[model samples]
Target: MIKRIAYLTSPGPTDRRGVAPGIVTPGFQMEFVQIGTPTLVNDPADLMITDLAYVEAAMRAQRQGFDGIVIGAVADYGLCTIRASVDIPVFGCGQAGLLTAAGIGDKFGIVTIWPETTAFTYDRILRDNPVGRQCVSVRYVSTVAEQAEIADEDGFYQQMQAGREGMMLRILAEIEAAVAEGAQSIVLGCNCMSPVASILAARSSVPVIDPTAAGYRSLESMLLLGLTHAKDPRLPAVSERGPAFAEAVAAVVGTLDEPEECPVCVLDEYGNASCEAPSHEAAPTSADGTAQ
Candidate 1:
């Protein structure tokens, strides 16, 4: 059984509320690591900066002998690289979100944070999965600028207050919106939004998809299956001097000039993107002044 699991994330209220619980659930011992937040540079090419940070963090965790690693971000930032770099299994919240949503119903809608990210995420999902047609819709709660504003301390507090005060109303509106658009269930698409998931579900008739719960269950299953942190034998070792492999690593970590296309992007029926990448970046500063 998997006794120990490592949960890596950027420092943020969202991560604390959504990702941490997945690690410490009943049967597992969890270790949480904080990394840098992924800042959106003017050039899209700089996206690799965030991706590389996650890989570096995973390598650190693997060296420390964690049983497995879970990248705890709604975006699933650097999943592919972390998986390739480590012998242990690496899971992403985004994948958990999709898998969880799928288990409950035929179609689901995602309520994510940024509009641009919604588009980018949708693109990634379509590229990764063969069954890209199952998603119903993926909507953004706020634009990137708005998200950034709310991510700040005062803004976050106000947003939280708004959510709490108008909890039922917001939940009802979101549910009605999704159902009207043909969603059988709703997936809390943002990590920050997870704390309110059960509240949303409690107020709605349909089910709510909680990525944290999904990720926790997935880790539990991996433990039960006795999975090992062994390298995939199919892939050649770096010592084998495979230029392509080296190039791929270089493409992912070398520079901010060109961001490699994430390999795990896939689509569900509703056109919502499924992220399988692990995040690499500094953790966001938390309002609570505690490490998330």
Candidate 2:
């Protein structure tokens, strides 16, 4: 059985908040690990700033003994490096998103945050899997300038509201265009859209693929595979440790004995509770042992 898993993400507890529940739903007992401190980059020249955060996450996951590592960003920064540095499988939300799309339909459309990143996202998809031809288009909802306008307000509620509305319209338009252009499904290209995918899908004729959930499900499959072939050298041994590993150990210890709220559902602006974490109550434990 896959008893433990780790989710490595960039700092900014709020940013981490968006993807955690997707990784720890029922059927999996996984710990969500955060790396680095919160960072905000306003200049396009500094856009790569998030890369450092992911690198830190990767290094921490390697030091601490994690069976697998899931990078939380949709941009998938440091994915290659993380994979190369770790013996265990390192999964990225972006890659999993693409794979999920391919599995569910002939073609998929990506809805992203920045227009400038569209090119980057496109290039990454193509380079990672040439099969990206199956992807219809990567659309951006909020450009850097747009996000800048509301980056500081109260949760950026007003801007996010406007952005979400605009995004919904853009997504609907893109879905219509993609369908007309031969796409059979749409992929939510950003982690923020994950909490609302089911709502989007419910209102649309085609299916909505949430990259975060897709990534989590991908990790689940890898865990099952690793557990099945317990002797595979590809799997990392559980005794790994390093000086920088204490944070991950602490994170696991903090969560293992407590019931964590569903991160996705909790962060949803709509107050929807569809995406919840695995119920700790259902976790099997001996009468005398604490639930993990």
Candidate 3:
């Protein structure tokens, strides 16, 4: 039977959008939706918007009866929250591509668009994967100027076509650098790079993995095996906080353009919550485990 999967996008998270083109395998119907206001994910404010948007998108996809959901960004925003919220197979492009490369090669290389953000995110996520250390090198591309010119799908396609050769050369150079650093496989770390994945794969000595393709194909394989995430330890819904706390918190953080100050005198007025993190400089003795 043909299964349905919702490919939820983070919009312009890295000045790029959606999965790399032409990676879908057969036997599954896929729906692509830009789930949030486009944001340049390297920016803290913008990244936060895309992060929470994934949670809402996953809930909607599950409610709509989709068989699976793919977080389209290679950075895989809100991966944990979405997986916990929904029972369906939630494929994160980063994990899919990284794990795929890990399985096939001794060490994989990542080439991303942004310099700092992706490297940091990959470092954090790689910790949870046993073979995460196998990701040897992460090379970055400086494509902000060109991507900023793109405003719509027509423009994006036009840009990709006009700059295809140039983009390929730049990416090819990065792939070479990764290989020099002992990367056995190259994983495209940005969704925008997906279009030229085949081109790079053909020219490069090592395998070139497109994260979008890996993620979609992973979800497809999971369905074929009738596998889904474990239902235990679900993200339990919040039934009650209070009209005061809910209203106050929402008013303070309702959107990206929220008020600088809490509208309700202070947040502690609601539920005794503080914007402070408990001091973790030293270990705590109490069983309740509030940090010391």
Provide the overall lDDT of each model, using Cα atoms, as 2-decimal numbers: 0.54, 0.53, 0.59
| Model 2: lDDT to the true structure | 0.53
Model 3: per-residue lDDT, tens digit, 101-173? 9988798888764443335556655775677799887787644343332333333323333346766677788
How far residue 32's Cα lies from its native spot in candidate 2, in Å, is 2.8
Q: Report how far residue 51 has shifted in candidate 2, in Å.
A: 3.0
Instruction: Please report how far candidate 1 places residue 55 from its true position, in Å.
Output: 1.2
Question: How many collisions per candidate?
Answer: 32, 0, 1
Measured against the true structure, the TM-scores of the candidates, in listed sequence, are 0.70, 0.67, 0.71
Please write out the lDDT profile of model 1 over residues 1-292, one tens digit for every residue: 5467777754322323434454466767776765543233222343455555556667767667787777665556567767666777777766776777777777877755334444654445434543335567776554445433432434432343235555446446756687788888776665545556667778776788767667656766777797743567887422222344435444643334333212112112232222223332342211101111
Clash pairs for candidate 2: none
Where in model 3 is the C-alpha error above 4 Å?
11-26, 143-163, 231-292
Candidate 2 — number of clashing residue pairs? 0
The residue pairs in collision within model 3 are 13-41
TM-score of 2: 0.67
Q: How accurate is candidate 3 locally (lDDT)?
A: 0.59
State the weakest 10-residue window (summed lDDT) of model 3. Answer: 283-292
Residue ranges of candidate 2 with Cα displaced over 4 Å: 14-27, 37-49, 152-167, 227-292
* TM-score comparison, 1 vs 2, better candidate: 1
Order the candidates by lDDT, highest first.
Answer: 3, 1, 2
